[model samples]
Target chain A: MCRAISLSPNSVLYAIGSRSFEKASRFMLENGFSPETKVYESYEEVLDDPYVDAVYVPLPTTLHVRWAVLAAGKRKHVLLEKPAALNLSELDTILEVCESNGVQFMDATMWMHHPRTAEMRALLSDGQRFGQLKAIHSCFTYKADDDFLCNNIRVKPDLDGLGALGDIGWYCIQAILWAADYDLPQTVTSWHEPELNQAGVILSCGSSLYWKDGRIATFYCSFLTNLTMDLSVLGTKGNLHIHDFAVPFRENVASYYSASQFRVPIMSEHSVANDRPQEALMVGEFASLVVEIEGNGSKPEKKWPEISRKTQKVLDAVRASIEKGFQAVQIVS
Target chain B: MCRAISLSPNSVLYAIGSRSFEKASRFMLENGFSPETKVYESYEEVLDDPYVDAVYVPLPTTLHVRWAVLAAGKRKHVLLEKPAALNLSELDTILEVCESNGVQFMDATMWMHHPRTAEMRALLSDGQRFGQLKAIHSCFTYKADDDFLCNNIRVKPDLDGLGALGDIGWYCIQAILWAADYDLPQTVTSWHEPELNQAGVILSCGSSLYWKDGRIATFYCSFLTNLTMDLSVLGTKGNLHIHDFAVPFRENVASYYSASQFRVPIMSEHSVANDRPQEALMVGEFASLVVEIEGNGSKPEKKWPEISRKTQKVLDAVRASIEKGFQAVQIVS
Candidate 1:
């Protein structure tokens, strides 16, 4: 992520921070950080730096509310890694603090900023080409080795808590919501018998989201299967399929398939090239928002935070459904 | 179908039948059936012809039991069109009579006979390549125009009582079972709020199938969306995805994508060519079975009826779930 920020023309790798000074300095040296960059022994010191315009929090999910709230309270723009918080309540607290401080906030879901995403969005929104969205299926899975299953932060209850759903499923949920133009689903129901580790941390799970308008989406995420990332959206008039939506197979160009009405349907492959990686584009977009807020005296962009909040809300509903024996949990938001 | 049989060296188009003699004659002429083909005014007449060793029944769901039973009673091998029957009981009757009469029976799920399907099955069966099956998601949908939605036999409740669940979902369910090596799921639960026509026939619906071993499959079928036939199976070590599982986009060759263990997963595109369409291969296979029963006096192939029965059993459970307000239905079989 720091590398991505450095690659963005609109952003600078201004500072580095870790709990230990040695770790921070090592990260800087190994990652080729500029020698002139400030290094902080603690996150608070980085937040306290007045020269720093924005802070990106890549901390564990359990610490998101604490550090993000602190960063926002310090009036720094916040870009936090996802599973934004342990739940929506924590996310709400972070968002509230950011709003009170008039600081821009966004989650680090890089694919949302991909140029191909914008192209997909346009195609989905076009009535003649895509028509009304009917159903979506997204899957993100990667086989976790014994080492990862035993020690990864994602499988630790205190660090990520939500496990596979929070780590990779968040991207699937976000993709579904994005395809639906950020419309919140009416109900969410978890699939039966989600695979969980000995600690009761989820290793694999799936859920279905239903809207009143009859638009439905299903997603599955796992740490127990081969690496697979796919998103398929079916509409009344057309269909869209991406083999790798969480991350592109190649950094330079990403491809998806699209097909319209036909008795014998034939899909046309569409690929979009990127001068910079999607993460860099995400950083550039965030930096641009900060530039508008800090340099031009404009209000922070509400769209980014709003999207993040919606994603978190649905995440909470999915968790609730899983907790309630896979019953349908209504999304009040 | 006549053309398919004509293309196969081992099969012959011996007869055509419909309620009206003119309609049967016209169909034979339109399909380029050999002039030696017998045109019968009624199905019973064709079934009564001792020279005909087998009969393909393409009647609607409502007529399946009566005609199929009569065809088997006449000691003719029966190749039935899909939605084998309205429910399991009706299918059981047909299967029992076929067994009693010592005649082979097969459902015309043409894709199952495709060479590509065998290739996919081979990959799925390989423990090293595909590992144990974990999950599957299948979708088969096609936009039915206003005229067809109002007038097509598929939308008529009495003619095809199961509607989309029977017409398209039959293929999805079969694909899921095939991927799982024909293992019957223990429970099936329909998705909520399936779209229904005025006659209460389902226009669109989805369901989830759960097995005792924690393997699960979800499928969606509709007559209300753009054409999409996708079957995605994820296993512990590898994944298989076919966008056109129900029918190939082209008549000659079909393709699917596969990937196995990798940190940065890369998919290999596989295409299998066919000298004839899948339907022809299906007819050829069925005819070979019939020839064995007659020419070689071999006992009927048990695999075909066993697979069809299992597919129908699950189809019945899905319909039961829908009928019981989306509750999970247990499969006794």
Candidate 2:
């Protein structure tokens, strides 16, 4: 909802496509969209729209690669929902298609654009404050909706990538990776509840990721939990905690105390208006890219296949750990 | 010094054994003790004191069981420092000597006596407040002394029990066990950093304990960390957090938070005072046992050995997990 509102000013809603055109038109009209915005009964009709410069694909997880590829082949930039594809093969196919057609492709992982994340990264790197980073702990959990069990794409393994790990675990993985400055995990292990579903998709997962420098990162993600989102980074000198990295409006800060006499800071909400920005910033970056392409012909933005490949590898190892009952998987890289 | 002063009214300080007895005596005198307290030439003389009703054995960890057995033979109640003994065999020997001679043997694990602990426990068990207890998380850690490499007992495997597990990890283990009403842990796993003389002792440990009724408790304890002592218990209705369990004088309190609101009562300093009460209460309990032994010829204190044995079994499994590099160790009843 926030993304649509943010992008509406610069980008026209070319056409609203759903299973029913009447419902799509109603949604568009209710959101203050123009009446000229065409209504398409099928996704194919929207793909056929020559004026459509980009496609925001929010379909079920299983159809992401199919629609992304179709949109890219039609010379349209594509922004796909998380767990970009069901597996490595599908993600690779989408990447190949987008590259061959010279169209931009990006997984809409808004957490990466959060400004507080950038601040945390800078804080960890600053020797005076954090010193050498040693470990990271992260958790993202919330209760599943009632409809989650009724043919929901999130519960389908072939569609939703790998259950909880794909839905919320991906954010935790990305947080740890970015905080550690993209250090490749040396090994990974995971544990999950077994009674959830037939796809053996993990509903809850706890994973340990080892880095080459002997640093460790642990994360937990669950769909059967009372909502919680937290992150902690431990270093030699001090530590930083983000109670809710998803919406970091205020955070509690503490440093290592060295003296007996110290003043207690009044408990006040420390607001960083620009501290942690959300994925909506990506729309602005995307807008800049559009302007760059439309105004002056410049070199294209750098593609991130390496990051995608590494992320998929970690995801695969985490899933393997869950299948084997949290057995440790030695990461070759 | 606080522990020593508590015993002064009834027991004579026959000897002070240290690299410098004068310095030790000065420390005692500064804390409101008489300078006439005997300064001993050796620790053996203190153990040899016939007038002593109890032996306050706070010697380096390796000497705990040796002195404890010697004191038990001399017919003195033994107040031994924690990590009761290095292994099960030594603990058995200490217990056997005390039992045969009819002397009281106690481990100085005092956090359980804090009043706030009882308050927190009551709040958690109240069906209207927190409902059924589901999970527990705890941590206890502090910075190592500068000369820890050369002089610290914690670095020596024989003295410090294992490493962090024996030194500080025991506190967390005891906390979890107490919160669950002494339920036996069904499984355990741990991770250790052995380079810092942490052999058989985990620097960082994460374990999941499954009770018979499907309740799960998880904990983390580390020695290679800044000072922190906190516990959070999740229940069906709400959660209770006992912040700073180890240091009650330092603004520690019990907090209860439900889905909609939270409450934190200002705790009086004496509410959780640690000084004298732990030893005084335990001694009072033993005094009652002494009366029962003399009058009814019954041995109610016999349950202490059983509890100690159970604690030892869990400790052994945690050590095994560290040796196997965090492999899960199932506890067999």
For each of the candidates, give the backbone clash count: 0, 4
lDDT tens string, model 2, B6-114? Answer: 5534434545655577787777787765666666656667667665566667776678778889888987777677777777778889999989988777676655545
**Where does candidate 2 clash, by residue pair?**
A115-A277, A116-A275, A116-A276, B62-B159
Error of 1 at A315 (Å): 1.0
lDDT by residue (A1-333, candidate 2, tens digit) is: 333424534555667788997788778777777667788999888889888777778887789878998998997777777777666778889888877877766677765555555556776788765666666767665556568855677787777747878887877887787778777787886643322566666666667787755476777776665454556666655555554665442322211112111112111122344422354555555546655655575434655444555666677788777777777787666
Question: DockQ numbers for every candidate?
Answer: 0.81, 0.21
| Real A-B contacts recovered, model 1 | 0.74
Give a tens-digit lDDT track for model 1, residues B169-288.
999999999999988999998888789999999999999898887788999999989999999999999999999999999899999899988434768889999999999999999999
TM-score per candidate for chain A alone: 0.98, 0.85
Which ten-residue region of model 2 chain A has the weakest summed lDDT?
A259-268
Accuracy of chain B in candidate 2 (TM-score): 0.79
